[model samples]
Target: MTDMRNGSVTLLEVAPRDGFQSIDKLIPTAEKIAIVEDLLSAGVSRMELGSFVSPKAIPQMADMKEIAAHFKGREGCRMSVLVPNGKGASLALEAGYPDLVFVVSVSETHNRANVNQSVAQSLDQLRAIVAEAGDGGSRLRVDLATSFDCPFTGDVPLDAVRKVAGEALVIAPAAEFALCDTTGRADPMTVAHRFEAVMREAPDETVWAFHGHDTFGMGVANALYAYSAGVTIIEGAAAGLGGCPFAPGATGNTATEDLQFAFEQGGITTGIDRAKLLDTADRIAALPGGKTASHLRIVPRGRAV
Candidate 1:
């Protein structure tokens, strides 16, 4: 059964990284920093702040280094950046970040297209990153992307996700594993069933995370299902920002405000201030093309002009 207690569940805000990357407008460094600061003040402990991918591919994240520099002295925040390869990993380490994250698609075709590397190649790189992180203040995590379904490949087999997850466990024994529904193709049933099955396989030494896209509007439902299935860490983006530029017709992520409201209303305490989160979402919506995917618009404190 899913654990829905205070200490049992954790949410990793992904708006700064996954959410902003998919947008066409360039979110200035100051604004990104301000948003993250707001979330931290609202009591979000862990957040995916940025990605270390090639600037050419994700121009939005090109300022990763600069942003990392800004957070150098911050406290009580576990900031992480997504690293695609050895180079990206090295950059993360050089930035003095204590945590690094890697993502690999469960679908072979999507893995190649997204990262220009095969599953094995990506796994090898992750292993190298783990080795480099060796006994430091930092930690490594590998997100098993497309665990639900792939845009390129119709349905990803559970066995395939398990296979790669197993291999990843060997390299980074202490690494956390995240099951990503990159295409938002996961339903509540699939989430509950598959996640329960996969959670059983997760090594006791590792933590488990769930990253669900809201492509089909099932993100929150799937998240609730995962929570019931023993997933502790839930990933979400602010303003539901993010979609694959290369992946056609891809939608944004599950909105942070909406998810927080759902959790709170469901009698689940996420230790987050819902009102503050809504305010943040509203601010983002005011930006150019910033109308977020969240429904908590027109907050009362501020005038809605």
Candidate 2:
């Protein structure tokens, strides 16, 4: 069941990391920090600020260390960074981040393309990474990319996802899992069914999150269905800014404003200030190559455009 104790839903803003990483232009570190501050002011308590990856592969995230330094120890916000391996995890821990997300794809082909490793190899590396970060007090989360469908392999078997997730739990018993709709191929029904199955398999204390791309315009629907199936953590990017550089034909994630609007209308509280979030979305849209795919941002409520 969705946690409605305070009539609020947890939304992890991913624009600064996931959204900005896909842009061809380098976003200045100062600008990134300002945008993150604005998001915090708009009631976003959790955010994926950036990734600790090779600068050559993702130059946009070259300044993750600086960004992490800026937000470290800030009150009332939980900062998370994506770590690709043990080395990345070391950097994140050294930077004082309290949470880390490691991504692995269910489809072997997509997994190789995204991380240049087979599923077994990645898990082997993950075991080492988990051991290296052992009892570090930092929270570890696994993002099972291509859990729904893989661009290279087409449909991914639910069993494949379950197997990888099961392995991840064995390696990091305290880790959470975020099922990713990497190519936006998941519909509402599929989202519900898959989430239910995973939930049934996950440990009692395991936390499950949903990461959906909006390639086919069903991101919000899929997220809502996941929520219906006991998922409480949802990821989104402001102005729908993001795409998998490694996944061909993949698109931006669900727009933060769009998801907030949908959840609020459905009587789910997101704790986000709608007006402020829309304003932030507009600001993001004005950046170079800032054009977004969010319906609400393009066609907002009230007033003649």
Candidate 3:
């Protein structure tokens, strides 16, 4: 049975990382900082501010180091960065950010396409990262990419996802876990089932997160379902600006504003100001060449537009 617990949820604002990385045009570092400041002011307690990947691979994230430097050790906000491989994890640890997110695909094909490695190889990388983060902050997390559906292979089997997740738990037992719908093809039924079954496996885990995209317009619904299934952390990007550049046809992430609105309506506490979040969404949407898909950001705000 699903928990359906609606007391509260942590919303991880991911515009600075996931949302910005998808845009083609370069958003000046100053602008990026400004956006982060705005997000913080909106009472966003946690966020994914950047990634520790190669500059050549992702030009938008080339300034990740500087961004980390500026926000390093800030109290109150739990800022994390995507660390794909061992090298990235090493760099992040050296840069004073032992907290990291290591992503591995449940689908073999998408794993090879996203990080140019097999699933086993990615797990090996996770082991190395876990070892590096052994005694420190140990904020390591495994993002089970394509946990629900994969663009290349279509719907991924839940057993495959569980196998990979089990291996990941063995690699980093104390680390957090996030089930990612890489292609946004997941429906509420699958979301509920996957999280429930996985959560049952780790009854002690209270920090499981759900990362979904809005490709099929079920982003909010899927997230709410995950919440019911006992997920605590919900990842959303302002303006819904994000997609897997590696996953063909995938769209932006579940919008932060939409999630807040849906949960707030049910009296779910997120500690975010709706007006400020909407304002931040507007700023993100105005970015040149930035594709957005949040319904709240577009609708009339008292006919002010």
Clashes of each: 3, 0, 0
**Model 2, 110-171: lDDT tens per residue?**
99999999999988877877876786213887899999999998999999988998888888
Residue 122 displacement (Å), model 2 = 1.2
Candidate ranking (lDDT, best to worst): 3, 2, 1
What are the lDDT figures for the candidates, one per model?
0.80, 0.87, 0.87
* Structural similarity to truth (TM-score) of each candidate: 0.92, 0.95, 0.95
RMSD of 1: 3.0
Q: Kindly report which residue stretches of model 1 are placed more than 4 angstroms away from their true locations once superposed.
A: 1-8, 135-138, 298-305
* Clash list (residue pairs), candidate 2: none
- The alpha-carbon RMSD values of the candidates against the true structure, listed in the order shown, are 3.0, 2.2, 2.1
Task: List, residue by residue over 62-86, the lDDT tens digit for candidate 1.
Answer: 8898899998757887888888877
The number of clashing residue pairs in model 1 is 3
Q: What's model 2's lDDT at 4?
A: 36
